[model samples]
Target: MMDLLRSLLFVLLFYPGTLLYVLTVIIVSPIGDAPVQAVVHAWSQFHHWLVRNVLGIRIVWDGAIPDGPFLIAVKHQSMMEAVDTLHFAQCPVVVMKRELTVIPLFGWVTRRYGVIGVDREAGASALRTMMAEARAAVSGGRPVIIFPEGTRVPYGTSPPLRPGFAGLYRALGLPVVPVAHDVGRLWHRGFVKRSGTVHFKVGDVIPPGLKRDDVESRVHAAINALTP
Candidate 1:
């Protein structure tokens, strides 16, 4: 019961407090995309403080965030992975669900910061459009981050990734950095939070070749290999 109460307190207090702390970020974020991006990055770091103190979750990185301007395939677990990525990489262009683009404050800010949205239901055609946008974003000097799994999965359960990652891989034709992590262990929905460490493993960048048009399976394998 104490654990549950603490968990509830952590969840309820964090959001409003976070917004209050970064009110300036929300207001000035609209000044320009880069300024907004910079604030969001700074906010993510601040967010780490909230998560660390309130939820008592620790994040530890075993490898390195590769040099930017490449399409990086990341395995998304729970919500923590989404929030934590800000501290892990140079503000890469995030591949997010189309629905998220409609949110009030975050949506507007993310759009300003150049997030690429995808409608998963539109199938292959949607993926092509997203890839094109990703290419343009990369050219603008930002790396693209995709959760190859396409959706969040529960701890220890692997969900099949949408094939969009393969399409992106071939279309972009840049080096791909595969990132894996143990985020769900500490941050899964309904799980009581306590003091613990989350491990993130950044693997070598897999440079592309002309003959291949798919790398989803390889990316999945690489990420899963890092799981405990």
Candidate 2:
């Protein structure tokens, strides 16, 4: 009963807060990237407040976050970590699906942040485009994050990575940092956001120039390090 009330409150607060933040972004967009980042940071901080005050959830980071100019391959179990990535990374740019670029306010902010989008069905051309954006983002001193599985897997499930991750690694020629976390049990894909600490464990940074298979295996193992 109490949990239900908290969930309701969280949902009620989230939409309005999101709208307010999006409006703020629009107003500040002309100021350039610093203001945009400030707004994004504030938005992330707002969600943190909601998680702790409304839902009684806390975040526990396990290791040192990488600096930048690197590729991050993360385990995708829920939306919680995706937002958390915004908090953990320094000057981060994410590799996301092209469809997300059309998502109204959210997509507007994504584009504002210079996120790289890929059309998976476009084959070689898509890879070329993704690589170009990724290269530019890295050259500009931002870490690139990609969810290896490409989509959220339910708790306790470990799926094989999508093909694009490896391609990005090879094309970008940056160190790959793997992040592991188990947040699905609490903040699931559904509506409920349970209370607890979500641990984000950072694994070793795999240097660039390795074979595709070698890189994939290393990243897969590193991301699942804390899974059991």
TM-score of each: 0.88, 0.94
Off by over 4 Å in 2: none
Task: Show where candidate 1 strays beyond 4 Å.
Answer: 18-26, 210-214
Give one digit per residue, the lDDT tens place, for model 2 in 15-81: 7998899889889999899999888878877887888899888778788876767888889887667
The per-model lDDT (C-alpha) reads 0.75, 0.84
Per-residue lDDT value at 89 in model 2: 80
* Residue-level lDDT for 1 in candidate 2: 68
Give, for candidate 2, the lowest lDDT window spanning 10 residues.
79-88
Among these predictions, the greatest TM-score belongs to: 2
